[model samples]
Target: MSRTLQSGYHRPRMLRHVGRFSPVRIQSMHYQSGRHIRLLLQPGRSLYDALVRPLQAIGVTSASTTILGGHFDHLEYCVAPPDPSGKAVIAYSSPIDAGASFMVFGNATLGKDMEGRPLVHCHASVRVEDGSVKGGHIVPQASIIGATPISVLVTALEGFELRQAFDDETNIPLLKPFKES
Candidate 1:
Protein backbone atom coordinates (compact mmCIF):
# COMPACT_ATOMS: atom_id res chain seq x y z
CA MET A 1 0.00 0.00 0.00
CA SER A 2 1.21 3.52 -0.77
CA ARG A 3 0.83 6.59 1.34
CA THR A 4 -0.84 9.64 -0.11
CA LEU A 5 -1.33 13.04 1.47
CA GLN A 6 -4.55 14.97 1.44
CA SER A 7 -2.95 17.18 -1.17
CA GLY A 8 -2.59 14.08 -3.36
CA TYR A 9 1.19 13.91 -2.92
CA HIS A 10 2.41 10.34 -2.81
CA ARG A 11 4.88 9.18 -0.16
CA PRO A 12 6.79 5.96 0.07
CA ARG A 13 5.55 3.33 2.46
CA MET A 14 7.61 2.58 5.53
CA LEU A 15 8.90 -0.95 5.85
CA ARG A 16 9.34 -3.08 8.93
CA HIS A 17 12.91 -4.27 9.15
CA VAL A 18 13.61 -7.85 10.13
CA GLY A 19 15.77 -6.96 13.11
CA ARG A 20 15.65 -5.40 16.52
CA PHE A 21 15.52 -1.64 16.49
CA SER A 22 18.45 0.03 18.18
CA PRO A 23 17.73 2.49 20.92
CA VAL A 24 20.35 4.85 19.62
CA ARG A 25 18.93 6.22 16.41
CA ILE A 26 21.65 8.80 16.06
CA GLN A 27 25.14 7.34 15.97
CA SER A 28 27.70 10.08 15.65
CA MET A 29 31.18 11.13 16.73
CA HIS A 30 32.79 14.45 17.44
CA TYR A 31 35.80 15.76 15.55
CA GLN A 32 38.06 18.67 16.45
CA SER A 33 37.98 20.22 12.98
CA GLY A 34 37.63 19.40 9.32
CA ARG A 35 39.62 20.72 6.39
CA HIS A 36 37.32 22.29 3.84
CA ILE A 37 38.15 21.88 0.16
CA ARG A 38 36.44 23.37 -2.83
CA LEU A 39 36.59 20.72 -5.54
CA LEU A 40 35.64 20.74 -9.17
CA LEU A 41 34.09 17.64 -10.63
CA GLN A 42 35.89 17.11 -13.91
CA PRO A 43 33.87 16.79 -17.04
CA GLY A 44 33.55 13.53 -18.97
CA ARG A 45 34.27 11.43 -15.89
CA SER A 46 31.98 9.26 -13.90
CA LEU A 47 30.73 10.94 -10.75
CA TYR A 48 32.48 8.34 -8.62
CA ASP A 49 35.88 8.88 -10.24
CA ALA A 50 35.57 12.65 -10.36
CA LEU A 51 34.77 12.88 -6.66
CA VAL A 52 37.10 10.15 -5.45
CA ARG A 53 40.28 10.67 -7.47
CA PRO A 54 40.89 14.32 -6.64
CA LEU A 55 40.12 13.82 -2.94
CA GLN A 56 42.31 10.74 -2.78
CA ALA A 57 45.17 12.67 -4.36
CA ILE A 58 45.02 15.09 -1.41
CA GLY A 59 44.83 12.28 1.19
CA VAL A 60 41.14 12.82 1.83
CA THR A 61 39.43 9.44 1.88
CA SER A 62 36.74 10.36 4.34
CA ALA A 63 34.57 13.44 4.01
CA SER A 64 31.11 14.96 3.78
CA THR A 65 30.59 16.71 0.49
CA THR A 66 27.96 19.03 -0.86
CA ILE A 67 27.59 18.82 -4.62
CA LEU A 68 26.28 22.06 -6.05
CA GLY A 69 23.71 22.24 -8.78
CA GLY A 70 25.12 20.92 -12.02
CA HIS A 71 24.42 19.10 -15.24
CA PHE A 72 25.28 15.53 -16.08
CA ASP A 73 25.71 14.00 -19.48
CA HIS A 74 24.27 10.81 -18.05
CA LEU A 75 22.80 9.93 -14.67
CA GLU A 76 21.29 6.95 -12.90
CA TYR A 77 19.76 6.53 -9.47
CA CYS A 78 17.94 4.02 -7.30
CA VAL A 79 15.07 4.16 -4.91
CA ALA A 80 14.73 2.06 -1.78
CA PRO A 81 11.56 0.08 -1.50
CA PRO A 82 10.43 -2.79 0.69
CA ASP A 83 12.62 -5.82 0.26
CA PRO A 84 10.53 -8.51 -1.34
CA SER A 85 13.03 -11.16 -0.34
CA GLY A 86 12.89 -10.03 3.28
CA LYS A 87 16.66 -9.68 3.62
CA ALA A 88 16.29 -6.31 5.30
CA VAL A 89 13.98 -3.37 5.58
CA ILE A 90 14.51 -2.19 2.05
CA ALA A 91 16.64 -2.90 -0.95
CA TYR A 92 17.79 -0.53 -3.65
CA SER A 93 15.89 -0.71 -6.92
CA SER A 94 17.79 -1.37 -10.10
CA PRO A 95 19.42 1.65 -11.71
CA ILE A 96 16.96 4.04 -13.32
CA ASP A 97 18.53 6.14 -16.02
CA ALA A 98 17.92 9.87 -16.02
CA GLY A 99 19.36 10.71 -19.38
CA ALA A 100 21.23 14.00 -19.61
CA SER A 101 20.01 15.25 -16.30
CA PHE A 102 20.46 18.26 -14.07
CA MET A 103 21.41 17.59 -10.51
CA VAL A 104 19.61 20.11 -8.37
CA PHE A 105 21.68 19.31 -5.29
CA GLY A 106 23.32 16.41 -3.55
CA ASN A 107 25.15 15.35 -0.41
CA ALA A 108 27.68 12.56 -0.40
CA THR A 109 29.56 10.76 2.31
CA LEU A 110 32.98 9.45 1.49
CA GLY A 111 34.15 6.30 3.19
CA LYS A 112 35.83 2.95 2.71
CA ASP A 113 34.09 -0.16 1.51
CA MET A 114 34.46 -3.54 3.16
CA GLU A 115 37.48 -4.18 0.95
CA GLY A 116 39.06 -0.84 1.89
CA ARG A 117 38.20 0.72 -1.45
CA PRO A 118 36.81 4.22 -1.65
CA LEU A 119 33.02 4.27 -1.42
CA VAL A 120 30.81 7.25 -2.08
CA HIS A 121 27.24 7.27 -0.76
CA CYS A 122 25.33 10.04 -2.44
CA HIS A 123 21.71 11.14 -2.61
CA ALA A 124 20.41 13.85 -4.84
CA SER A 125 17.46 15.53 -6.43
CA VAL A 126 17.65 15.72 -10.17
CA ARG A 127 15.67 17.03 -13.08
CA VAL A 128 15.49 14.27 -15.65
CA GLU A 129 15.49 14.87 -19.39
CA ASP A 130 11.71 14.53 -19.32
CA GLY A 131 11.58 17.63 -17.10
CA SER A 132 10.25 15.75 -14.10
CA VAL A 133 12.23 16.29 -10.92
CA LYS A 134 13.04 13.14 -8.92
CA GLY A 135 15.14 12.34 -5.90
CA GLY A 136 16.90 9.13 -4.94
CA HIS A 137 20.14 7.42 -4.07
CA ILE A 138 22.54 8.40 -6.84
CA VAL A 139 24.44 5.77 -8.76
CA PRO A 140 27.77 7.56 -8.79
CA GLN A 141 29.60 5.01 -10.88
CA ALA A 142 27.01 5.24 -13.63
CA SER A 143 26.49 9.01 -13.67
CA ILE A 144 28.77 10.97 -15.98
CA ILE A 145 29.61 14.59 -15.49
CA GLY A 146 28.68 17.12 -18.13
CA ALA A 147 30.97 19.17 -20.38
CA THR A 148 31.31 21.90 -17.74
CA PRO A 149 32.89 21.42 -14.37
CA ILE A 150 30.72 20.90 -11.29
CA SER A 151 31.61 22.37 -7.90
CA VAL A 152 31.70 20.52 -4.59
CA LEU A 153 32.33 21.66 -1.03
CA VAL A 154 34.06 18.98 0.97
CA THR A 155 34.64 18.70 4.70
CA ALA A 156 37.45 16.23 5.15
CA LEU A 157 37.12 14.14 8.27
CA GLU A 158 40.30 14.10 10.31
CA GLY A 159 41.79 11.93 13.07
CA PHE A 160 39.32 9.21 12.18
CA GLU A 161 38.09 7.39 9.15
CA LEU A 162 34.73 6.15 8.01
CA ARG A 163 34.49 2.48 7.22
CA GLN A 164 31.70 0.18 6.21
CA ALA A 165 30.89 -2.43 8.85
CA PHE A 166 28.17 -4.92 9.36
CA ASP A 167 25.24 -3.57 11.35
CA ASP A 168 23.32 -6.23 13.19
CA GLU A 169 20.51 -3.83 13.88
CA THR A 170 19.80 -3.33 10.21
CA ASN A 171 21.32 -6.56 8.97
CA ILE A 172 23.30 -4.59 6.45
CA PRO A 173 26.62 -2.83 6.07
CA LEU A 174 26.85 0.81 7.08
CA LEU A 175 29.53 3.47 7.39
CA LYS A 176 30.83 4.10 10.90
CA PRO A 177 33.62 6.24 12.29
CA PHE A 178 36.74 4.48 13.51
CA LYS A 179 39.99 5.72 14.97
CA GLU A 180 42.66 6.02 12.29
CA SER A 181 44.77 2.91 12.38
Candidate 2:
Protein backbone atom coordinates (compact mmCIF):
# COMPACT_ATOMS: atom_id res chain seq x y z
CA MET A 1 0.00 0.00 0.00
CA SER A 2 3.10 2.22 0.08
CA ARG A 3 3.55 2.40 -3.71
CA THR A 4 3.83 5.95 -5.07
CA LEU A 5 0.87 6.32 -7.49
CA GLN A 6 1.88 9.80 -8.71
CA SER A 7 5.38 9.40 -10.18
CA GLY A 8 5.53 5.75 -11.39
CA TYR A 9 2.18 4.59 -12.66
CA HIS A 10 1.60 0.95 -13.62
CA ARG A 11 1.91 0.60 -17.42
CA PRO A 12 1.71 -2.51 -19.54
CA ARG A 13 4.91 -3.55 -21.31
CA MET A 14 4.52 -3.48 -25.07
CA LEU A 15 6.29 -5.24 -27.91
CA ARG A 16 7.11 -3.16 -31.03
CA HIS A 17 7.13 -5.52 -33.98
CA VAL A 18 4.17 -6.98 -35.79
CA GLY A 19 6.12 -10.21 -36.30
CA ARG A 20 7.67 -12.67 -33.85
CA PHE A 21 10.64 -11.79 -31.68
CA SER A 22 14.24 -12.00 -32.91
CA PRO A 23 17.07 -13.14 -30.68
CA VAL A 24 19.95 -11.32 -32.35
CA ARG A 25 20.65 -7.61 -32.29
CA ILE A 26 23.47 -5.42 -33.54
CA GLN A 27 25.42 -7.69 -35.89
CA SER A 28 28.71 -5.89 -36.49
CA MET A 29 32.30 -6.45 -37.65
CA HIS A 30 35.75 -4.91 -37.38
CA TYR A 31 38.59 -4.46 -39.89
CA GLN A 32 42.33 -4.18 -39.37
CA SER A 33 42.49 -1.04 -41.49
CA GLY A 34 40.26 1.00 -43.81
CA ARG A 35 41.21 2.34 -47.23
CA HIS A 36 40.39 5.85 -48.37
CA ILE A 37 39.82 7.21 -51.85
CA ARG A 38 39.15 10.57 -53.43
CA LEU A 39 36.73 10.02 -56.27
CA LEU A 40 35.56 12.51 -58.85
CA LEU A 41 32.11 11.69 -60.05
CA GLN A 42 32.38 11.95 -63.81
CA PRO A 43 30.26 14.60 -65.49
CA GLY A 44 27.45 13.55 -67.82
CA ARG A 45 27.06 10.21 -66.07
CA SER A 46 24.38 8.89 -63.79
CA LEU A 47 25.21 9.23 -60.12
CA TYR A 48 25.13 5.46 -59.87
CA ASP A 49 27.58 4.88 -62.72
CA ALA A 50 29.77 7.75 -61.63
CA LEU A 51 30.24 6.29 -58.16
CA VAL A 52 30.14 2.59 -58.88
CA ARG A 53 32.27 2.02 -61.99
CA PRO A 54 35.44 3.72 -60.82
CA LEU A 55 35.36 2.03 -57.43
CA GLN A 56 34.75 -1.29 -59.11
CA ALA A 57 37.85 -0.86 -61.27
CA ILE A 58 40.05 -0.43 -58.20
CA GLY A 59 38.81 -3.59 -56.41
CA VAL A 60 36.90 -1.54 -53.89
CA THR A 61 33.96 -3.83 -53.34
CA SER A 62 32.56 -2.16 -50.24
CA ALA A 63 32.72 1.38 -48.95
CA SER A 64 30.96 4.15 -47.07
CA THR A 65 31.08 7.45 -48.98
CA THR A 66 30.52 11.07 -48.18
CA ILE A 67 29.49 13.16 -51.19
CA LEU A 68 30.33 16.84 -51.14
CA GLY A 69 28.08 19.52 -52.64
CA GLY A 70 27.76 19.46 -56.43
CA HIS A 71 25.38 20.11 -59.30
CA PHE A 72 23.13 17.62 -60.93
CA ASP A 73 21.46 17.95 -64.31
CA HIS A 74 18.45 16.24 -62.76
CA LEU A 75 17.81 14.45 -59.48
CA GLU A 76 15.21 12.25 -57.86
CA TYR A 77 14.62 11.07 -54.31
CA CYS A 78 12.18 9.02 -52.28
CA VAL A 79 10.94 9.13 -48.74
CA ALA A 80 10.29 6.19 -46.43
CA PRO A 81 7.03 6.10 -44.57
CA PRO A 82 5.23 3.44 -42.57
CA ASP A 83 4.29 0.31 -44.41
CA PRO A 84 0.53 0.05 -44.96
CA SER A 85 0.41 -3.73 -45.43
CA GLY A 86 2.36 -4.53 -42.24
CA LYS A 87 4.64 -6.68 -44.37
CA ALA A 88 7.72 -4.56 -43.71
CA VAL A 89 8.60 -1.83 -41.25
CA ILE A 90 8.56 0.84 -43.99
CA ALA A 91 8.55 1.29 -47.74
CA TYR A 92 9.93 3.93 -50.10
CA SER A 93 7.45 6.34 -51.61
CA SER A 94 7.23 7.28 -55.28
CA PRO A 95 10.13 9.17 -56.83
CA ILE A 96 10.03 12.96 -56.51
CA ASP A 97 11.97 14.80 -59.18
CA ALA A 98 14.14 17.86 -58.58
CA GLY A 99 15.05 19.17 -61.98
CA ALA A 100 18.53 20.70 -62.31
CA SER A 101 19.47 20.32 -58.68
CA PHE A 102 22.41 21.03 -56.42
CA MET A 103 23.43 18.39 -53.94
CA VAL A 104 24.25 19.84 -50.56
CA PHE A 105 25.68 16.83 -48.75
CA GLY A 106 25.17 13.10 -48.69
CA ASN A 107 26.00 9.86 -46.84
CA ALA A 108 26.11 6.77 -48.99
CA THR A 109 26.80 3.16 -47.93
CA LEU A 110 27.78 0.85 -50.73
CA GLY A 111 27.24 -2.90 -50.59
CA LYS A 112 26.07 -5.91 -52.56
CA ASP A 113 22.38 -6.51 -53.06
CA MET A 114 20.64 -9.85 -52.67
CA GLU A 115 21.44 -10.62 -56.28
CA GLY A 116 25.14 -10.02 -55.54
CA ARG A 117 25.30 -6.76 -57.50
CA PRO A 118 26.70 -3.47 -56.27
CA LEU A 119 24.18 -1.23 -54.52
CA VAL A 120 24.45 2.28 -53.18
CA HIS A 121 22.19 3.40 -50.38
CA CYS A 122 22.38 7.19 -50.49
CA HIS A 123 20.57 9.88 -48.58
CA ALA A 124 21.07 13.60 -49.12
CA SER A 125 19.86 17.16 -48.71
CA VAL A 126 19.60 19.13 -51.91
CA ARG A 127 18.58 22.48 -53.39
CA VAL A 128 15.95 21.88 -56.03
CA GLU A 129 15.39 23.72 -59.27
CA ASP A 130 12.74 25.91 -57.66
CA GLY A 131 15.34 27.03 -55.10
CA SER A 132 13.70 25.02 -52.37
CA VAL A 133 15.70 22.67 -50.13
CA LYS A 134 14.68 19.08 -49.38
CA GLY A 135 16.18 15.82 -48.16
CA GLY A 136 15.59 12.11 -48.77
CA HIS A 137 16.99 8.88 -50.16
CA ILE A 138 18.40 9.48 -53.63
CA VAL A 139 17.76 7.37 -56.71
CA PRO A 140 21.36 7.47 -57.88
CA GLN A 141 20.97 5.54 -61.11
CA ALA A 142 18.38 8.02 -62.32
CA SER A 143 20.20 11.12 -61.11
CA ILE A 144 22.39 12.62 -63.85
CA ILE A 145 25.61 14.41 -62.91
CA GLY A 146 25.86 18.00 -64.08
CA ALA A 147 28.48 19.52 -66.41
CA THR A 148 31.01 19.86 -63.59
CA PRO A 149 32.48 16.88 -61.82
CA ILE A 150 31.58 16.17 -58.19
CA SER A 151 34.02 15.04 -55.49
CA VAL A 152 33.37 12.15 -53.12
CA LEU A 153 35.32 10.90 -50.10
CA VAL A 154 35.34 7.16 -49.97
CA THR A 155 36.12 5.10 -46.85
CA ALA A 156 36.60 1.65 -48.21
CA LEU A 157 35.91 -1.19 -45.78
CA GLU A 158 38.65 -3.72 -46.28
CA GLY A 159 39.27 -7.29 -44.96
CA PHE A 160 35.48 -7.39 -44.63
CA GLU A 161 32.75 -6.38 -47.02
CA LEU A 162 29.28 -4.89 -46.81
CA ARG A 163 26.23 -6.72 -48.11
CA GLN A 164 22.49 -6.60 -47.72
CA ALA A 165 21.31 -9.04 -45.12
CA PHE A 166 17.74 -9.63 -44.06
CA ASP A 167 17.26 -7.90 -40.75
CA ASP A 168 14.52 -9.55 -38.77
CA GLU A 169 14.27 -6.68 -36.31
CA THR A 170 13.37 -4.18 -39.05
CA ASN A 171 12.00 -6.75 -41.50
CA ILE A 172 14.15 -5.33 -44.29
CA PRO A 173 17.21 -6.19 -46.35
CA LEU A 174 19.66 -3.52 -45.22
CA LEU A 175 23.35 -3.09 -45.93
CA LYS A 176 25.29 -4.73 -43.09
CA PRO A 177 28.95 -5.10 -42.32
CA PHE A 178 30.14 -8.60 -43.23
CA LYS A 179 33.29 -10.60 -43.82
CA GLU A 180 34.92 -10.55 -47.25
CA SER A 181 33.60 -13.25 -49.55
Candidate 3:
Protein backbone atom coordinates (compact mmCIF):
# COMPACT_ATOMS: atom_id res chain seq x y z
CA MET A 1 0.00 0.00 0.00
CA SER A 2 3.02 2.27 0.22
CA ARG A 3 4.09 4.50 -2.69
CA THR A 4 6.65 1.88 -3.74
CA LEU A 5 4.05 -0.87 -3.99
CA GLN A 6 1.37 1.28 -5.57
CA SER A 7 3.84 2.43 -8.18
CA GLY A 8 4.36 -1.26 -9.07
CA TYR A 9 7.92 -1.25 -7.85
CA HIS A 10 9.14 -4.68 -6.82
CA ARG A 11 10.02 -5.12 -3.22
CA PRO A 12 13.39 -6.34 -2.13
CA ARG A 13 13.75 -9.99 -1.27
CA MET A 14 12.43 -10.76 2.18
CA LEU A 15 14.47 -12.51 4.86
CA ARG A 16 13.27 -16.05 5.02
CA HIS A 17 14.35 -19.58 5.71
CA VAL A 18 14.77 -22.46 3.31
CA GLY A 19 12.24 -24.65 5.06
CA ARG A 20 8.49 -24.97 4.42
CA PHE A 21 6.51 -22.35 6.32
CA SER A 22 4.24 -23.68 8.97
CA PRO A 23 0.65 -22.44 9.10
CA VAL A 24 0.67 -22.01 12.87
CA ARG A 25 3.03 -19.16 13.48
CA ILE A 26 1.85 -18.18 16.95
CA GLN A 27 1.86 -21.13 19.29
CA SER A 28 0.04 -20.52 22.56
CA MET A 29 -1.49 -22.14 25.60
CA HIS A 30 -3.71 -21.15 28.50
CA TYR A 31 -2.92 -20.89 32.19
CA GLN A 32 -5.30 -19.99 34.97
CA SER A 33 -2.82 -17.79 36.80
CA GLY A 34 0.85 -17.13 37.30
CA ARG A 35 2.85 -16.85 40.50
CA HIS A 36 4.79 -13.66 40.97
CA ILE A 37 8.11 -13.73 42.77
CA ARG A 38 10.79 -11.20 43.53
CA LEU A 39 14.10 -12.89 42.83
CA LEU A 40 17.52 -11.57 43.66
CA LEU A 41 20.50 -12.57 41.60
CA GLN A 42 23.17 -13.12 44.19
CA PRO A 43 26.59 -11.70 43.62
CA GLY A 44 29.35 -13.92 42.17
CA ARG A 45 26.93 -16.43 40.66
CA SER A 46 26.64 -17.03 36.98
CA LEU A 47 23.52 -15.39 35.61
CA TYR A 48 22.23 -18.80 34.60
CA ASP A 49 22.60 -20.32 38.07
CA ALA A 50 21.27 -17.23 39.78
CA LEU A 51 18.17 -17.22 37.67
CA VAL A 52 17.62 -20.94 37.41
CA ARG A 53 18.52 -22.30 40.83
CA PRO A 54 16.22 -20.13 42.90
CA LEU A 55 13.35 -20.59 40.51
CA GLN A 56 13.88 -24.30 40.40
CA ALA A 57 13.94 -24.44 44.19
CA ILE A 58 10.49 -22.90 44.22
CA GLY A 59 9.06 -25.44 41.76
CA VAL A 60 9.05 -22.92 38.95
CA THR A 61 10.40 -24.46 35.78
CA SER A 62 9.02 -21.91 33.31
CA ALA A 63 8.85 -18.17 33.72
CA SER A 64 9.20 -14.75 32.19
CA THR A 65 11.54 -12.55 34.20
CA THR A 66 12.32 -8.86 34.16
CA ILE A 67 15.92 -8.23 35.14
CA LEU A 68 16.38 -4.93 36.92
CA GLY A 69 19.23 -2.65 36.06
CA GLY A 70 22.51 -3.57 37.73
CA HIS A 71 26.15 -4.37 37.15
CA PHE A 72 28.01 -7.55 36.36
CA ASP A 73 31.59 -8.59 36.98
CA HIS A 74 31.61 -9.97 33.46
CA LEU A 75 29.12 -10.26 30.63
CA GLU A 76 28.98 -11.91 27.24
CA TYR A 77 26.45 -11.73 24.46
CA CYS A 78 25.90 -12.86 20.91
CA VAL A 79 24.29 -11.30 17.89
CA ALA A 80 22.17 -13.19 15.41
CA PRO A 81 23.05 -12.96 11.75
CA PRO A 82 22.41 -14.77 8.53
CA ASP A 83 23.67 -18.34 8.68
CA PRO A 84 26.58 -19.08 6.35
CA SER A 85 25.79 -22.77 6.39
CA GLY A 86 22.15 -22.19 5.40
CA LYS A 87 21.01 -24.68 7.99
CA ALA A 88 18.59 -22.15 9.45
CA VAL A 89 17.28 -18.67 8.83
CA ILE A 90 19.77 -17.11 11.20
CA ALA A 91 22.31 -18.29 13.75
CA TYR A 92 23.76 -16.77 16.88
CA SER A 93 27.30 -15.57 16.52
CA SER A 94 30.11 -16.60 18.83
CA PRO A 95 30.02 -15.06 22.28
CA ILE A 96 31.28 -11.48 22.49
CA ASP A 97 32.61 -10.39 25.83
CA ALA A 98 31.28 -7.20 27.37
CA GLY A 99 33.54 -7.09 30.39
CA ALA A 100 32.43 -5.55 33.69
CA SER A 101 29.14 -4.47 32.17
CA PHE A 102 26.25 -2.55 33.59
CA MET A 103 22.93 -4.00 32.55
CA VAL A 104 20.61 -1.16 31.61
CA PHE A 105 17.71 -3.51 31.23
CA GLY A 106 16.97 -7.14 30.48
CA ASN A 107 14.31 -9.77 30.05
CA ALA A 108 14.74 -13.49 30.29
CA THR A 109 12.76 -16.63 29.80
CA LEU A 110 13.35 -19.86 31.71
CA GLY A 111 12.67 -23.03 29.83
CA LYS A 112 13.88 -26.53 29.16
CA ASP A 113 16.32 -27.20 26.37
CA MET A 114 15.79 -29.86 23.75
CA GLU A 115 17.70 -32.26 25.99
CA GLY A 116 15.47 -31.38 28.95
CA ARG A 117 18.13 -29.32 30.65
CA PRO A 118 17.48 -25.85 32.03
CA LEU A 119 17.77 -23.00 29.56
CA VAL A 120 17.82 -19.31 30.26
CA HIS A 121 17.33 -17.18 27.19
CA CYS A 122 18.05 -13.54 27.95
CA HIS A 123 18.47 -10.27 26.06
CA ALA A 124 19.74 -7.05 27.52
CA SER A 125 21.15 -3.61 26.87
CA VAL A 126 24.38 -3.04 28.71
CA ARG A 127 27.16 -0.55 29.22
CA VAL A 128 30.41 -2.43 28.97
CA GLU A 129 33.63 -1.87 30.90
CA ASP A 130 34.75 0.35 28.04
CA GLY A 131 31.64 2.49 28.61
CA SER A 132 30.07 1.62 25.26
CA VAL A 133 26.39 0.80 25.28
CA LYS A 134 25.28 -2.33 23.41
CA GLY A 135 22.52 -4.86 23.33
CA GLY A 136 22.20 -8.49 22.27
CA HIS A 137 21.34 -11.98 23.47
CA ILE A 138 23.08 -12.36 26.83
CA VAL A 139 25.19 -15.44 27.53
CA PRO A 140 23.84 -16.21 30.99
CA GLN A 141 26.17 -19.07 31.80
CA ALA A 142 29.28 -17.04 31.20
CA SER A 143 28.17 -13.75 32.73
CA ILE A 144 28.98 -13.32 36.40
CA ILE A 145 26.98 -11.10 38.70
CA GLY A 146 28.63 -8.12 40.33
CA ALA A 147 29.18 -7.40 44.01
CA THR A 148 25.57 -6.42 44.72
CA PRO A 149 22.54 -8.57 44.20
CA ILE A 150 20.44 -7.76 41.12
CA SER A 151 16.69 -7.95 41.46
CA VAL A 152 14.29 -9.69 39.09
CA LEU A 153 10.54 -9.96 38.89
CA VAL A 154 9.41 -13.40 37.90
CA THR A 155 6.03 -14.43 36.51
CA ALA A 156 5.92 -18.17 36.81
CA LEU A 157 3.74 -19.97 34.31
CA GLU A 158 1.45 -22.60 35.73
CA GLY A 159 -0.33 -25.64 34.25
CA PHE A 160 2.02 -25.71 31.26
CA GLU A 161 5.68 -25.78 30.40
CA LEU A 162 8.08 -24.12 28.03
CA ARG A 163 10.31 -26.50 26.12
CA GLN A 164 12.64 -26.21 23.19
CA ALA A 165 11.84 -28.35 20.18
CA PHE A 166 12.91 -28.48 16.58
CA ASP A 167 10.95 -26.25 14.27
CA ASP A 168 10.80 -27.28 10.65
CA GLU A 169 9.62 -23.90 9.38
CA THR A 170 12.78 -22.17 10.53
CA ASN A 171 14.86 -25.34 10.87
CA ILE A 172 15.87 -24.37 14.41
CA PRO A 173 15.16 -25.28 17.98
CA LEU A 174 12.75 -22.86 19.63
CA LEU A 175 10.99 -22.53 22.95
CA LYS A 176 7.27 -23.14 22.87
CA PRO A 177 4.52 -23.72 25.36
CA PHE A 178 3.11 -27.19 25.83
CA LYS A 179 0.83 -28.98 28.22
CA GLU A 180 2.53 -30.16 31.40
CA SER A 181 3.78 -33.71 31.04
lDDT ranking of the models: 1, 3, 2
Cα lDDT over the full model 1: 0.94
Residue clash pairs of candidate 3: none
TM-score of each: 0.90, 0.88, 0.92
- In candidate 2, what are the lDDT values of residues 1-181, reduced to their tens digit? 2555676558865547655677767778888888999999999999999999999999987999999999999999999887898887678999999999999999988889989999999999999999999999999999999999999999998888899987776687888887777
List the lowest-lDDT window of 10 residues for candidate 2. Answer: 1-10
User: Which stretches of model 1 miss by more than 4 angstroms?
Assistant: 1-16
| Model 1 lDDT tens row, 50-128 | 9999999999999999999999999999999978888887889999989999999999999999999999999999999
Encode model 3's per-residue lDDT on 55-78: one tens digit a residue.
999899999999999999999999
lDDT of 2: 0.90
Cα-based lDDT for every prediction: 0.94, 0.90, 0.94
Candidate 2 stretches greater than 4 Å from native: 1-15
Worst 10 residues of 3 by lDDT: 1-10
